[model samples]
Target chain A: MIQFRPIYVICLREFKKFFREKSRLLGTLARPVLWLFVVGNGMNSLIRPQVGFSYLQFIFPGMIGMTILFSSIFSSISIVWDREFGFMKEMLVAPISRVSIVIGKAISGTFISVAQAVIIMVLIPFLGIHLTVLQFIEVVLVSILVSFCITSLGILIAARLTSFDGFNIIMNFLVMPMLFLSGAMYPVTSLPTALRYLTHVNPLTYGIDAFKHVLLRNSAPPLGPEFPLAVDLLVVTILAFIMIILAALSFRQKE
Target chain B: MSIISVNNLTKKFKTLTAVDGVSFSVNEGEVFGFLGPNGAGKTTTINILCTLHLPTGGEASIAGYDCVKRPDEVRSSIGLIFQDTTLDTGLTAYENLKFHAYLYNLDRKLTEKRIDEMLSVVELTNRKHDLIKNFSGGMKRRLEIARGLLHYPRVLFLDEPTLGLDPQTRNTIWDFITTLRKQEKITVFMTTHYMEEAENCDRIAIMDHGKIIALDTPENLKRLVHGDTIHLVTEDNEKACAEIAKTFDILCHAENGGLFIETEKGEEFIPRLIHSLSIQVKSVNLRKPTLNDVFLKLTGRTIRDDVLSDDKEVTREFVRSHRRAQR
Candidate 1:
């Protein structure tokens, strides 16, 4: 049987460690601020959006997506660290089901990512983007769902990794490609046909689309959600379940 | 009754048979030790018994639960302190034990009581709030011991519990272990190549080449060797060696600038041999046979050969796991 106490304690350990490392909090926070101000503002004067919103406001949700993507994936690297430092064996030998470990890690990653996503929302007023109360609630809901989805995907990959030697490869090959192809920095429709197929397959694409559905509600067709709100939520929710289950399965086979 | 029983258990990697048809049983309250050099499969056998690795052949059980089939049940009933430090350095000592208690599903009240009890047992009660990174190597090990017993498991498995500690700290750790064994009623099953450390075990199984070569109490295993060992350093080493062999009819070998001989009573023999020798006897040292001598008698090698082979084995394991991660 899946034990809830193990899951709770596992998540608690991650939470305590995350807060204890002040540098880690600063590092995750600094990335999005740099992207939103330098990258977004610098590119704003060049590529003018067809819509009434400025490029800074246009990619706001994309910036939140970027924050979630990096932090969630970064959080999963704890598994590799645990393996290297011998703490993974501690949890592996525990009586709890392996599923509890995976779920605990996924939930912690979700909370940490969602927390960073909320911190990025503080930049909303400065970017001149106004949202109604209902829109803000919807945005938080989507952030939670999207964070859970991406973190589960992170856990899925981290579950199979035995060392940090593969970490750079994962960052270069997996994280970078997912960010570029997810329409996080630009519109998916503007991409070539071949790359557009990749965006449709990328789980983060739906997550960002869901973000846009709430954040950029009044925007034009191409700049708005590519698919319907229902489609985005359904895809992310389904992929979240699949990734978590697969992560737990892979974790059980960890030898 | 035997708390742990193994019947022809074996584990095979692709290129190596780490544990080969090993069988042994550990009594409920004894300190059972596996004495072996590096790469001898002591850790492999412990891993299998702890439910971390599946045995390729044979049956093993703890507390009447099969290791492979009822792993969850087996795991919950045992405590394990690995060869390397497994304590999380980022958390405080109290936090680490609390986390372990939760993982083992200890009740809230029982967790508080046990955490406090174990911390004091290891003498870390004062350092409970401090982060583990600041603690010494000995403290970390002691805390890990405390965490392992938070659930009060029946069998406490310590894989090389004192592999690289100073003599003083090792003694302190051993003291805590001995006291805790009685207080908590635990059956300790540990593995160590340190002969003196193995002397602490009520019974020891000398493992070499993935098989138990000798299994008995410390005194009994020492008796397997001939007798007391005598080391003689004389003014004329070559002549003394010849004279001792020819006159006494006892074979002696020269090693490290000293002539060594094993006899039933080295103290009595040394006085007679020193007077009979033509050359001046510089010094004579006689001591009881140690576990190292027992290992030498069995394997034709000393356990101190832990340097080159151990480094190579570690690198080989790293390369193998690196390749697996690459896939």
Candidate 2:
């Protein structure tokens, strides 16, 4: 069995690394904050809600969801840099289980990505949406799980990339497209019929829905119609497990 | 038992064998140098020893842990300075050391005390608070060395630590390395292509074509190669140099600017060499042969150029795939 030292060490190192890039920290924090502030207000002009809620109220959960999605996907870019820099070589040679390193990345990536998500999460009420303490905590836990899943997926992609150019190309081709197609920007059903499958395949879809139900819907989740809560949870959970395994397997390449 | 034992360890990339059945061992606290020309697989072997690459065949164990099966233990037992600069340019040097100290499980107070001492050792104590991005190449290299030593590993593997450094900085680094050896009992295994560098080691292994061609102390290896070396410089190009070599038993041969040959009694042989070649030599020297002569004798080739031609080379092709990694 893996012990606590590896996990603790990896996680601590990962957390420190996130703060290393001042521009990255700013970009990460500012992206979600702007979405919650200006964009949340700007969209109120064009968007009309059918439910008895303002546009800000309707868009709040999606913004929180967007924060989690972007931050989680970008977490792997640092890994790409680390690989090119040879820090990955140093990490691989450390006296720890390669599997725990992924868990540690998840810990670090999730901590920052979720921190970004929570920044937006806190700003929701300032833009006129309200939530109770229990509901807020529930949304935060879902953010943590979803962030973990997304971050591990990023690491998986990073392992195969050889250079910053390759990593940038992947970010543009894969992450950007995936984030745009997910339920973070609009309700899942609002996507064109042709794009429904895209959202269905996106783990971000269920994550967004879970937050929306707890934050905006403030009611029983529409399990069958809006989204299958159980299936989304299952997909995220499974992907997290697979990605962690793949990250461990990919780590030997550094050796 | 050997502190490090690598036997028949090999790694292949498709059809190219990077390390071919190479085997060697280092006793406790010895300054072992791995010397080779570029692309000669010195880095490949060190990577294997540090548990950074899995051998395609055979096995390597460091401090009694199997490299393939017990990589973690190998990691803990050894420290590595990679061929590429792996320092985080974003963080201050202090932060970088602290971060690594955590990975090595050094406590906060102890880590703080040691980081301070290491900074002074590298002569970067005042600069420790500055971001590594702004540091010069030599300073960066020194900081990297300090970082590698933080955990106080049993064996420290330095992969061309003085590469691209100015002579003064290289001297400083050399001094620091010797000081480290004297003060700390850490075994330092360094790789270099420079013959002068091999002379600094307690023992040296010279590799070519993925195998060690020669392994011994510099003085001992030089003893294997007899006679003094002569650098024959002439205005006339290849013809006269070729004629001179044909006229004598040239022990060492090089074709850079002129003929560099080694033979017994270089002083006595020079007059005959000039008379036979029908050329008056511009200069002649009867100097003792260095380790470079030993390498030339063993490999039957002089490493004058990095490659015969820069274009259409295997090494260039390999490095091209990682082009964006330069950033």
Q: Each prediction's interface RMSD?
A: 2.8, 4.6
lDDT of 2 by residue, B1-327 (tens): 468888988877556677889889988888999887777788878777876666789888888888888877788888888767888887789978887887778877899999999998888999888988899998988998998999889999999888888889888889999998998888889998777777899889888778888888888888887878888777774767567657664533556676777678878887787778766567766768787777777876655455464532576365334323321
Q: What are the per-residue Cα lDDT tens digits for candidate 2 across A198-220?
A: 87777777777777667666343
Instruction: Grade the docking of candidate 1.
Output: medium
**Model 2 ranges with Cα > 4 A deviation:** A1-3, A29-43, A190-194, A218-225, A228-235, A252-255, B107-110, B235-254, B267-277, B285-287, B307-313, B316-327
Candidate no. 1 TM-score: 0.95
TM-scores for candidates 1 onward, in order: 0.95, 0.89
Maximum-lDDT candidate: 1
DockQ of 2: 0.41
Report the CAPRI category for model 2: acceptable
Residue A160, candidate 1: alpha-carbon lDDT = 78
Candidate 1 lDDT by residue in tens digits, B1-327: 999999998877766777789999999999999998887888889988988877779999999999999998999999999988998999999999999988888899988998999889899899989999999989999999998888989999999998789999999999998898778788999999889999999999999877999999999999998989998999988889899889989888777688878899887888898889989988899989999989988987778865356664784485346434532
